[model samples]
Target: MEALNLNVENTSSKKVTKLPPKISPKHKRINVLEEYKKRNDNKVALNLVVVGHVDAGKSTLMGHLLYLLGEVNEKTMKKYERDSSKIGKSSFAYAWILDETGEERARGITMDIAITKFETEHRRFTLLDAPGHRDFIPNMISGAAQADVAILVIDSTTGEFEAGFEANGQTKEHALLVRSLGVQQLVVAINKLDVVSWSQDRFNEIITKLSPFLNQAGFKKDKVIYIPCSGLTGENLLKRSQNILEWYSGPTLFQQIDKFEPPIRLLDKPFRLSVSDFFKGGISGMGGITVAGKIEAGTIQIGDDVLVIPGGEYGVIKGLEANDESSKWAAAGDSILMTLSGLDILQLKVGSILCSVSHPVPVTSYILAQIVVFDIKVPITKGFPVILHRQSLNEPAIITKLVTILDKSTGEIVKKNPRCLPKASSATVEIKLTNRPVPFETYKENKELGRIMLRKGGETIAAGIIINILSYNS
Candidate 1:
């Protein structure tokens, strides 16, 4: 087995200089105390991702909830209704709110992660509606990797549940993937129950079969909440409908959202932001570029000098906005948009990590990882080529060595340098990226920075966590 390397040296050869903060025209200084007060008053921000198999009513459920919350007005709803009816797809009118793309609307499937913001009485949310189609699993993985909590929408219309929960369906794959990536709390919304006349027996039957599977996937029975709902008719969403569900007296979807415990923010760690999207121009034709992503750790203030890892590009924070509201500083867990100066647009791209220059994430080509293998026809062996996904970055990589295979039940070593890792097994292995180094941290230190997914031929093979960076390449 290769020993883990804990020490990392600064690999950049360029002269380090302290640059003055370059404030943008839209910049405004935020007082620390005032910011704290605002957070306390508004409650902590949370990123809630909705996931399930295709045609399971995820988009419709969320869109209707947003409409009930007045996030979508009657006028806009009328327009969606009229437009969808013209295409003979009136059932998709509610889904049109989150499925903005024409392709998504035409196909009636979520092809990519659709991000939108909403607020409840107690918490503000960044809702990520992930695609459920098998072809779009990579996109779904990207969205789930960023989520703090998840809402798994299950279809309850006769055989729809069985079809989605069976082998090759996305429900099982998505459930295991999110739990492996560290989503602790889940709300399983049994949607389309109205189709079965809100049958309690059907709901109970679904739960009886799924509980063990969810437990195996790492969700605690107590942490998993089951809610019966009708995304089409808007029952048990924002408000409960007593007429349909007279036997069950439980909290609505919004209430369950309010009960979610906010994750502890790593605000004191080194600032790390993964660039998810970037644009060429800034406000008012400003020369600077605008970068949008979530702050994974620590705090970033206006005019703070930032280093773009793997590229060694420097930029200054020209402006910052959290939840589409302008602000001076952004802390961990905030989805922010930042205007950056001092780097050309070509130097910045998706998967770029923005960090404070003094404590930037290490760039490495080789890493030691603890991986959980998913069910696949073939076992994973040494020198197996696969596609590696981290944050928004996806690259080709190979498993260089199978160090040790561990017991899936007790996590004890079963064999050293096992010949192959079979389905539903666990192991520690060395992975080597093919072309360039990536910015990564160990899972113990930073969850968002340390996670990765392995895929091959459009199938997700395994999910892994970085235990250590074994080697670095300049």
Candidate 2:
């Protein structure tokens, strides 16, 4: 029977009902308001990325998800089959939504971000089916940069959880990149469950092996929901299959996906501003996100004193608007366009945070860090130029010390006295900023401001967080 409930609010306006004349008895019995409201309620959505070792079923899992949600029809499924022979696998699903160039499809690897939309029973999902190849992993990194949630699709048959047995396979680097990009939650989809012949043992094995890394990534045990299903068979997807393998009793992948919440910062402090996409709004102001962090204590208004230490430049607030409406006080997370009092249009640009002079402590020398050595082919040594970025600031710094290398797989210090960070590694290092007055948070409190990426030769080599710096006194 279709689920039934009563909602006082009318949903006729939200739902465009167009179904076949013949309806199921359950559909006929639904409480109109309840049913329609459920359908019309603004869905709680999180950007879920399907990533893992290449051919680890990232595409298949997404296709299955689309299929389960009934986003794609039977005709499309058949088309996938027809294209699979031509394209090598059901990658046509990836090609279909990703809109890859002909060469990209023929290669069966994602060269860039493939954004597509689909809806589930309870939530609308925006799936970013990213590339899983090593050479093209940068594109995946670019995609993960935008994802709110990450779904790592692993094939039990392949065996390696982070490292892969297959040549030209994907790696834990992919997972590390997702974490580095500030994705808050993870969902491991053990694809091709039928190939293992529905063996709970294999699923358990993958989970057992991945348990350590999952924990290291700061994800709760329950957060890693394992779905034992065949992307081929479409088992236990959208439908809340009650009696399927009674051993598993939690919500289906669909239900879990629907319930998963996107992580967003609650603007607790006043006027803790972050610059979103910014630009020139005349000879006057700049615009961007109320993207968490609020304005408080300091009375900031038109012609108010605004000093941005990020650029070591001062300006005045000529005006502020909450979206299109004129807002007297703009708090955190409100996209606003504001005019400047004295600064030129070139002064305040993107990634600049607005704050009072004494608000967030701006330091000359601070310890900025990362998980470190994410997919680094060479060793990261001291005195190297480390590219650091947080919120909207990206700059280069000299690595004062290697300090220590923490295991990326596990946050354990491998070396107390070290000089180089090796391949596929992580570490906690003490760093002195080449430039002063950068805003950073302790990783324990707010990750958005705490972390940074270390780059060299156009590639991001290591990423870590900012620890307190060694102060010099004469």
Query: Local distance difference test, per candidate?
Result: 0.85, 0.56
**Tens digit per residue, CA lDDT, model 2, 176-249:** 66777677678777777767666788889888877787666456676667777656566665543445455666
| TM-scores vs. true structure, each candidate | 0.93, 0.61
> Candidate 2: which stretches are off by over 4 Å?
1-43, 73-91, 99-101, 117-124, 158-169, 240-250, 262-264, 269-367, 370-380, 385-397, 402-446, 455-462, 468-474
- The alpha-carbon RMSD values of the candidates against the true structure, listed in the order shown, are 3.6, 14.6
Q: Which ten residues in a row have the lowest lDDT in candidate 1?
A: 1-10
Cα lDDT, model 1, residue 208: 96
Count of backbone collisions within predicted model 2: 22
Highest-scoring model, lDDT? 1
